[model samples]
Target chain A: MTALPASTPRKMGLVIDLDTCVGCHACVTACKGWNTENYGAPLSDTDAYGADPVGTFLNRVHSYEVTPAEGTPFTVHFPKSCLHCEDAPCVTVCPTGASYKRAEDGIVLVNEDHCIGCGLCAWACPYGARELDAVAGVMKKCTLCVDRIYNETLPEVDRLPACVRTCPAGARHFGDLADPGSAVSRLVAERGGMDLMPEQGTRPVNKYLPPRPRDALTATPAATPADPSTEGLGGFLGWIDRTLARF
Target chain B: MHPAPSIILFTTISGLGLGLLAFLGIGMIEPTGLAAFLWFTLGYGLTLVGLASSAFHLGHPERALRAFTQWRTSWLSREAVLAAVAMLVLAPHAIGLIFFNRPLTGFGIIGGLLALQTVLATSMIYGQLRTVPRWNHWTTPTLFLISAITGGALLSGLPFLSQMLLAWLAVAMVLHWILGDSRFAASGSTLGSATGLGARGAVRQLEPPHTGTNYLLREMAYVVARRHVVPLRLIALLAACVLPSVLLWIAPFSLPAIAAAILLHILGMLTARWLFFAQAEHVVGLYYGVR
Candidate 1:
């Protein structure tokens, strides 16, 4: 049961735009809130008010500074979560049949009931997407909001993943990546989206659109501004200017 | 690669125990009655103790029985199954020697092979992890198997075999360290590649995901002291291979010498195992620029 499906009917995943993310961590908060309340286990925090607080989260945001060969350096906000790879090593390495990848949607999920909490799946992940809940004693991961994606109870507009729906920058997009004609696929094709650590051979369903090139100041001379006229002879100002002129 | 004490003890102690059991099963030390009982008890005791310590590393040790169900793909599951089967097969041979003074060659051979395979399976658990570039190699398994064999040969009182294997193990240990040192660089993983920002130029982490440590950082992005690495490697090699080899060469059958050799050997192995986990560089560290 831990073996990955040969192929999925639809690769439901995210296409994150690095150029648009503002590093506000809104998506991270939204994901934490929705998943803690609705998903397998409530993402518990140990010593919430103490000096050191450690908690399990399904998503996180990181910021990096990129220095170009010919342009100025700039910061890029990076939000990371489970990419739900087609060849997910995390699922297969599980000793218990707890972690699994869905053949229907290609979403990787963990069955808390079956998990032994060996943390091997977390070790297997290259992206650090899996986390072991300290209180729940089970592995936790991004489910891609499996409960909400197909839910008919909520309005159609509110059916998206909490992260995507709440991202203030509209940096995250979700759809079937398996379909070449899907909006997510089209966006990937148009923006030259890339897979993180492609050499890892995970074949991640989610793609990241690289940050666009930023404009730098050109090395050209600019016209000088007109000299300030000392025509307004204020009492103190005029005396100071005249005294300096004597030198 | 945090190098948890429970894991270090589990791997090193179990490897040594399994190694000794393999030798005992093959009739390397022909003892009967009380002697056979003592040796078999020591072997089983060490193996069980090592295994029991590993349970503490698990978040839910009570559900460990479920681990046996996934041998089809998981190496950890295969290790559990192989270790259990090995012990079961060796049980009858051990009983025969202790009660009937008969060495069951057929059962012994089968059990010996299974016990050795359990060491291989144990090694594969770490080797199979591609995320840790330093461990994802054939050398990882080779190192583990060699250590187990050498430790087993020494414990079996085979002087010539112990000396030879110790020399070989020394070479293997040095070679493994040298190769492991370059694995992360050779892995072609960088901050640029991890972030998919290589084309723009060099990528460096400006800020981590959180101000406080998280599970990923605590578990994978460990940073061992660089200054202590060389001295520790020296200590491990000296204690594990060099001193033990000298003792065997000088006094092939002295009781105190064998006792000292085993003690030094275990100490050396513990150091080496600790280094094995601590030195490993997981690819995920690139994301935080930890390496």
Candidate 2:
């Protein structure tokens, strides 16, 4: 089962825009809230109300400061999760047949019941997408919100992934990446979406839209004050114009 | 890599065990009756104990048996199956020698070859990992094979073979270190490449993903200072090969010298194995700004 299917019916994935993300962590919190309750295996925290708290969550946002050669430094909030790769190394490396990609949707997932938690899947994943649940003794990762997305009982509008639904900036989009007609696909085409590390060769299903060009107009320089008291005839005219503008 | 004590113990001890067994299979070790029994017993002991310790390293030890189910795909599964086959063959071969006074026969030779194959499979488990560039090399299996054979040769007290294999082991060990150092220096990953920020020229992490240490940091973000490696490598070389070979040379005259050589070699191998795991930079560390 760890050997991937030759073809999947649909590659369900996410496309996130870096330009719009404000890094509020709403999506991170929403993902935690939804997955902990929905999945059969709760992503447990080792110490919920202790001095040093640590828990297993599928998605984590990494903040990085990038300084372009000619421009000012800017921070990019990189939210990483299981990319549901076309060729997921995690699935191939699983010895117990626990880690697998769904043939129908291409959503890489782990069957907790069968996982030995050897941590092989984690090592295989360069993205650090998978983590071993120390409490449950199994590997865990982003399940693509499989429980919620396919649930017919939920309202149609609310049937998307918890992260996508809660993204206040509308930065996150979820749909079938295999279909070029999907909204996520169109968004990818328009924004020139990219993969995290194409060199690693995971062939990720998810795409990321790069940050927009930073304009000096928005990041304005400090203003030098003009002393109107010591200049020529134009100074009194400028002062009059400035005084008129203030009025 | 985390440099888990159990794994270090497993590879080192098992390497020695299978090395000795390989000598037995080739009809190189000369022993009669109970001595032969004891020799086989000791070899199997190291292999099994080392294997058992590795199994214990698993998060769920009870599910360790399920690892054999995916031999066709997983390297771990291949190791399990090959090791099991070696054990099965070795049992009867050991029985024949101990009870029936039979010298090394067809089955015994097969058992020895299987033992060597099992060690190769074990080495392949790490060597096949594309994530850890340091481990993904030809030197890995070469080092494993040479160490096993040399250790076995020493145990057999075969003076000429021991001398030759010890020399080969030394050469292989040095090659592994030199190649490994270069591999570390020339790591294919960079902070820019890992983050898809190569075009930006320079990237820095003002804030990490988490405030506290997480599983990735604990498991993959291990770093060893450069200052410690050179001295340690020299120590490993002296203990594992140089002194062991010199002691093994003296072993032809002194009956107990072989034991001393084996002991010193094991210590050296332990140090070397620790470096192996500690030095392995998993490419995932790129995400944490570690090169």
> TM-score: which candidate is best?
1
Q: What is the i-RMS of every prediction?
A: 0.7, 1.4
Clash pairs for candidate 1: none
Span of 10 residues, lowest total lDDT, candidate 2 chain A:
A227-236
Query: What tens digits encode model 1's per-residue C-alpha lDDT throughout B122-177?
Result: 99999999899889988899999999888888877788899999999998899889
Compute each candidate's TM-score over C-alphas.
0.96, 0.92
Give chain A TM for each model in order.
0.91, 0.88
Residue-wise lDDT of candidate 2 within A6-54, one digit each (tens)?
8898999999887788888888899889988888578888867887778
Off by over 4 Å in 2: A216-247, B184-187, B224-226
lDDT of 1 by residue, A1-247 (tens): 8878989999999999999999999999999999999968899899888999999999999999998887778999999999999999999999888899998999999999889888999999999999999998899999999989899998999899999999999999999999999999999999999999988889999999998767667765586669866766779999898888799
- Residue B77 of model 2 has an lDDT of 78
> What does each candidate score in C-alpha RMSD?
2.7, 4.3
Classified by CAPRI criteria, candidate 2 counts as medium
Which candidate comes out best when scored by lDDT? 1
